[model samples]
Target: MSGAPAGRAVAWLPVARPLTLVPAPPPEAAAAALGTVWPALRRALAGDAPLAVLPAGAGPADAARAVLRPDRPLEPGTDLVVVTSGSTGGGKGVLLSAAALRASAAATLGRLGGPGSWLLALPTSAVGGLQVLVRSALADREPAVLDRGEPLAAALARLPAGDRRYTALVPTQLRRYLADEPDALASFDGIVVGGAATDPALLARARAAGVRLHTSYGMSETAGGCVYDGVPLDGVGVRVAEGVELTGPVLAHGYRLDPAATGEAFADGWFRTRDAGSLAADGTLTVHGRLDDVVISGGVNVAPQAVEAALREHPSVADAVVTGRPDPEWGQRVVAGVVPAPGAVPELAELRPWVAARLGAAAAPRELHLLDSVPTLHTGKPDRRAVARLHGGDQ
Candidate 1:
């Protein structure tokens, strides 16, 4: 291979006929599928061609249909195609180069002390999981595939130990480990957790469980994570205006064939993330959710995450997700979906004041819904669209 072989998805670069790396359910099978698809992939790999990596269930059609990107033309030196489904269900493929992938993996390895094996806990179809495979490939190490169905401890025990061990996980995966025994959590030398916003409590608990948790912030466009534990990795840049703007080596080339969207997203080489965030005096970035997440309630803009965070502070509430439901009086009323802790029952009356005391009445949930568990995508991020449907609400 000309460039260092990328993760599980790009591993197929040498084999598959410029096909999308589809992510099937259960990360282990997706991780294992890479090897099984190798022969076909290996044959395809011979052409030294560039490939597009789309989400699973994209298509089996050849590159003409699969990669004939009219939205944003693939630039020279591009080798990876990643799809990012936006909040509106309108998605686009983010074009990344081999240089970008290596830069990201190198920055990660540098931050973590050195290269080593990785625990593949996310779907290979996604950039998060793909990066793990890429990093492993660059190090010439085999990654340990964690089956979501198995016990985390047992799965971890099976991974071959190496000089420097690391794993990538989303908040949902980290939450599971926070409950496991301490030793099981300590097995990884470094745990690079990203994919979606992470609750501070979850990170604290993970650390308490002996996990060297590093909260990361990035997306497919960044080739994975450009920030680790609130620090931008080497050669990466971060600044917040109305939202976060990320630049530097880790940044993606642009969207595949979508000039309008690409121009809107990448201006002056800085990719503008629609996430509302701020920089501290020390330059730590604190994300406040998406710009669209702000809801108008009674002629005032209220952040649902603020209400959600306040509700989740209740001992009876194990987890909380907040959204807006249409209301004639308020335009959009604040709504909360809560998961109760064991032996605890959360009530609207109890929750309202809990949030009111901390965040005032404007931040209190006008409607309450106690859930068994939050609805999540297969990749383990909150399925807010599904949650909205669960409450008969639309945003």
Candidate 2:
């Protein structure tokens, strides 16, 4: 076992075929160890597949024995598989290689001023969370994992005070931090917010509160976030084709066991993200929303993000999500789910005029629903489908 630190036990796990209960290590050390362990992992996974990665808190030895079995035919093209964020549909698995993983880690470190100790608030199973562990291992620092179930204040309190720390959060997390623990926001040198469209109001709030926040744009295929604050990071490249085409060091090799998806998403060494973005004259990129986020209302295309942005500018609106609900007259009509500022309830009719002045009458919501909280996925992104299902019709 590696004697680095109490949390750095991932390095010492035995190289057996069955599932391993290795402790999570720093990114750099973990990468180096993975170089050694991957060949064995591949070989073992080929036979009876005596390896299983026990979930957190499982007994290591027992977990190993339970999963070990005799040799079997290796599944062709099956390697490291990661699930994609199911924002649009059901989640799909993506395959990755050790080399691809390392290249992504290296590229990310190179771009983001090199890795330091990370404070992981996201789940490790998620691509964003997995990248944190990978980056920390590559940087030779043990990441401090925040309890997912803990309150934001309590979680922030657990992080050590003086180290240069990094953390990734979805926009909702940023909003919560800004609302609940303004002081804790300053603890990190940099904070990355992504996985959904961030409201202008939230960004303004964070900036006003003196939090260093960078809006990120990337997905699992790009090996986590390659773009930071609208600029492609070092070793990362961006292009606008049908949507946003991204390339460079952080790009993944391909999907696990699915050549067709690999071919469809990647073209000429670039990963084509279905997200729509435009580069401004000053060279900052502004992500509009997903290409599919556009809805036709009375034969006019209405971008929900455009409407949401306008609503967020209102002082009475604390948070807003704009989506389309089915309408017989207009195919799909614009609707807003809003969270009003504490003790201030703004009527839907009044909010519509406010949005119309900013985004034009076509962009105004036909109906508004006051919600205590908008439904969000585990990734902290708004669940548009759920919202649509809940209030798509009947107004």
Which candidate should be chosen as best, given TM-score against the real structure?
A: 1
Encode model 2's per-residue lDDT on 1-395: one tens digit a residue. 74566765455544423233233233333333234333333443344332222223234223322332213222233333455546677555554444555667676666556666677776444567667766676676656656544555565555566666778888767877787788888777778777777777778889999888878787777767777778887767787877888888666667544568779997788888888888877767778788887877888888887787788778788788878878889788898999898888878778878987887777888888888988875455677777877884532
The estimated TM-scores of all candidates read: 0.85, 0.77
Off by over 4 Å in 2: 1-79, 148-157, 281-283, 392-395
lDDT of 2 at 29: 35
Best by lDDT: 1
**lDDT of every model, 2 decimals:** 0.73, 0.66
Query: Per-residue lDDT of 165-245 in model 1, one digit per residue for the tens?
Result: 788888766766666556777888998888778877677767877789888888888999898888899999999987999
Q: Scored by Cα lDDT, where does model 2 land?
A: 0.66
Error of 1 at 214 (Å): 0.7
